[model samples]
Target: MKVKFFFRKKEPQFNSIEELFDAVSRKLSVIISVESITMPYGKISFKNIFKNIKYTRANSGKLNHITGHINYVTLGLKGKTILTIHDVGSTLNGNKIKFFLMKVFWYWIPALSVKKITVISEFSKKELVSIIPFAKDKIKVVYNPVKEELKYQPKEFNASCPKILLIGTKSNKNLENTIESLKEISCELHIIGKLAKEQLLLLEKLEINYFNQFFISYEEIIDAYQNCDLLCFASTYEGFGMPIIEAQAIGRPVITSNMGAMKEVAGESACLVDPNSISSIKEGVEKLIDDAEYRTNIIHLGLKNVERFKIDKITNDYLNIYKEVIEAK
Candidate 1:
């Protein structure tokens, strides 16, 4: 059967949603076609809404299944569409206006039209259900799959001055607190995303040794995980922490937030800390550095944790969902 996967237009920066479904498409057994649709420009745009509606209506019967972002949900394909809601982060951040608007467009409207809604983590599913209580019945939890190419590469840890990998530069990533926590700690910070001017200034003022790069390839991301002594992902919030699994698959011990999906994704394998507490972050890092056995144990746990997210298992999960949606039609 042919399935049409509708995706948002690719942005230059990191986007987990696109990365996820791309992997899903590669593994599915059915014929798949991907369509990139433009995102709405403003908070609520009638023009973009009409454009999306027209686009979906035009392609209604051309394929067996339609799937894309929740924001792109249209009323045209009542039972043939599936919507993926990554997170209700905007609602969680206390943006009341955005919350109300999202409740209307992102949840309630899509609930009427889409055949299924998938969330990456149980934490996200719970959060989404709290906002739209009626949606609890329809949502499914599908974990994101680690790329098949990422595998265990045993690399010796640098005891002298370890290299700590940091994946994102967004404010919610809690990079500022992480920097403060590592102020006196001796380690090289290898950051993946571009840093803001204020962040660079703070790093310089704190005298933290760091390297920052942007727009790197997937192979480079794997290299980052393989080379680093540990992965630090103390984000304040997340739908599902992909880096946690990626790092684990490469045999790197992880330090992540003790809240939300980070904690859920890490399971018992990662050193968890309060993202709001600089001292907690510091202490977690210190434990990983000062205690060799504890660190080694966590690394072994991480290797095992990664097995749950194997690409083949996650692919089959999506395949089942697609089959269910198509059979219902």
Candidate 2:
């Protein structure tokens, strides 16, 4: 049977979902097509929303897959469809009116329209269920597969003056706290996202040695993972912590939060830290830096842990769901 993967016109830097499904679709034996909907000037106006919805409806295939971030289009879709929700943060973080509207259009309506819903982690499934409890029975948990490009690259551990990689700068990513933790620590911080004015000032005030880059290519991202001594991903919240597995897959040790999906995803292979406490995060990093044997042990365990996120297994997981949804009543 043919399947159509519906996607939004994503920015160059934000193509993880597209890249993920691109890999998944290639491994599937069935015929596949891709459809990307665009909005005028890339802004979400009502006119653009309706136009995109109409476009999506007209192009609906035998089996439809609504990728994350553009769930409202599910309202206009006919036939069997599956919706993948990476997180419910967008709906939960805003003011009351915005939250109400997002709940209606983004979660409630689209959820009712789809035959099956796939969430990236158990934490995400619980979050979605809490918002729309009736939809719980149909929600399935699927972990994000580690990218195939991130091969296990063994590197000599840089014990002296180690280069620590931090992936994001968002508030929930806990970048500010991480920076605070690194104060007086002997390591170079390589951050992957654009910094705000306050963050830059904080770094300067802390007298930390750091390098920052934004909108980098996937190759650069892989290089970042491969080159770093350890990944510091102490996020306050996440649907699924992708970097934890990615670092593990690359044979690098990881330090991440001990709560939410970050803890769930790390699964004993990472150095777990309390995201709220700078001292805890610092101590985690410091242990990895000072103890050679412990760091090596974490890296080896991480390599084994990444097997759970293998692409073939994850691809088969999606294929099974596709078959079930297509064959359902």
lDDT of 2 at 45: 81
Which window of 10 residues has the lowest lDDT sum in candidate 1?
Answer: 35-44
Task: Report the number of the highest-TM-score candidate.
Answer: 2
Candidate 1, residue 96: CA error in Å?
A: 3.0
Give all candidates' CA lDDT scores. Answer: 0.80, 0.86
Q: Write model 2 residue lDDT over 1-329, tens digit each, in one string.
A: 66778887778657678777767777764444444434222357898788888888788776888877788888768879999999988457778898898888888888788999999999999899998898888899988998889999998888888899999888898999999999978889999998999999999999999999888888899999989989999999998988899989999999999999998888799999999999999999999999989999999889988999888999888888988997888
Candidate 2, residue 36: the lDDT equals 44
- The regions of model 1 sitting more than 4 angstroms off are 30-45, 61-70, 76-79, 91-95
> How far in Å is the alpha carbon of 317 misplaced in model 1?
1.2
In model 2, which regions exceed 4 Å deviation?
Answer: 29-41
